[model samples]
Target: MLASFDIGALGHSFWALTISGLTYGSIYALVAVGYTLVYGVLRLINFAHSEIFMLGMFGQYAALMMFGFAPQGDAYDMGVAQTLMYLGLAMIGGMVVSGAAAVGLERVAYRPLRRRGAPALVFLITAIGASFVLQEFVHFVLPKLTNNTLGGLNAQQPIRLVSPSTQFTIFGATVTNVDIAIVVSALALAFATDRFINGTKFGRGIRSVAQDPVTATLMGVSRERVIMLTFLIGGVLAGAAALLYTLRVPNGIIYNGGFILGIKAFCAAVLGGIGNLRGALLGGLLLGVMEMYGQTVFGNEWRDVVAFVVLVLVLMFRPTGILGESLGRARA
Candidate 1:
């Protein structure tokens, strides 16, 4: 059996791994927020959410193709202005597609069940079923629909709009333009979401529903509307995360691309406090850094195992997470 740990390599790559981990964690943070928000209000796992993120990936790719980008063997090099435009457009495309898909999912998959007073286990099964349905639809139906132009159970070609060239060194670790963009954009979006959940009237309504749906309904908060909004917010954030994720893994936008990352994002949400927005952000960043450290210490093959182990340990010790609180306690 291979030795379980290797400390020497870790010490050598500490700074580089730290920087890269932060970049990866930022993407997780964005996706985690979606999981956190929907859970906060609905108290549902929304397993099909991974599919929403996957749709965002396809959405942005479709947008890029519409903008005249084509697959090539080598990465595309573009000016900063052009790159920024493409990035903005792709993110927007992703956000729109994901947000719409989420709403449709609510309207179609969960709404009827909710109206019929379905049990939690039933909802869980429905979510999983919806997830597979979306995946299969993309893998099988999309190819025929597009005349084999879009989908076919294969990894999509790389979208190389932005080159990940090193822009500067931070604490002896190289930071690329993509890294800066991912972190800054994710932080900005996270902050905005935090404010939306904790400071606004709508935010108050969401918290009220989370705390006591019947009371909120009696107070004139539309429960149905809140649920729809929650899904929309989660989907939009997932879509943003999808673009950032593609930036990190240029060729990773496959039909099942979101499954593993989505699970990690959910783990981040749970690690931080399942129903807490800021907690999800904290959990994501921590998980990313820890995963990198684990990879360095135990080799790349153990990267994911390390993350899951951390999750199990965290749950065993501090089940409420680092910033333990539900959405109701967010502003409290």
Candidate 2:
């Protein structure tokens, strides 16, 4: 792959790749938070979380459809105000769907198992099973319900809410309006989440529970509520990410769309230190940039391999990750 590589192209598109990488990384960071938060509190991977992200994608699509948007034909060119309004509604729809799915998963699958004092293996199996069930439900059942419009094994085209018009240029790279919206909005949400996790009474409860559930429970923190809240936050972020993702890949919305991204996001969480929020952001940006650079150097076909290789090398050196796992120390 390296033999045919155009090294000069890498230099020429350095800024462009970096910008695109950051955009992709922002989405990864958003999704990674869901994994990290759930892991921190429950010490479980919550494998079904990816499906939650997938559901968010459909939720936003469905919302737009309800607003008179269609899968194909001429793209909508509504005024800026109307476009933002529709986008906002779509995001809210995504959040509600993803949040409800997450909570339901916990209540129906994990919570009952936890109450029964099930082993770690049982929880892991259940999570994996739940993930498949959700995906298949979307794949086989949802398409039928939407008259083959929203779901199924086929990829659904999202209504183009934001046209990717070039907004600015930096260091020879042209940035689009969608790029700015995705990066800025994702950063804002990440910052707000960090603040909420570190600055609120509920945030304290979450950290306390993550540190020690028994002690936190004794101290009057409701474990169930904290778990629910963590899932809700994760879902909301994922929902927002779904909107941003649609902006990036309008034709890429499908049941399996979230699978690879979800894996990458999980990799990002581990790369950043699985339980660390700031680490997820850092890891995501780093991974995205590195993956883009890898594509430039190793060719597009090797991009995914390069990403996983980097992950392995990082783990070989620092298993705890770049910042280390410490939900408790995050506030400090």
Off by over 4 Å in 1: 1-4, 330-332
TM-score of each: 0.97, 0.97
How big is the positional error of residue 56 in model 2, measured in Å on the Cα after superposition?
A: 0.3
Q: What is every candidate's alpha-carbon RMSD to the true fold?
A: 1.3, 1.3
lDDT of the structure predicted as candidate 1: 0.89
Residue 262 C-alpha lDDT in model 2 = 87
Model 1 lDDT tens row, 175-252: 998898899999999999888888889889888998889989999999999999999999999999999988888888
lDDT, model 1, position 136: 91
Q: Give the TM-score of candidate 2.
A: 0.97
lDDT by residue for model 2 over 193-290, one digit each (tens)? 99889998988989999998998999999999999999889888988888889888888788888888988888899999998999999888888998
> Which consecutive 10 residues in model 2 have the weakest lDDT in total?
1-10
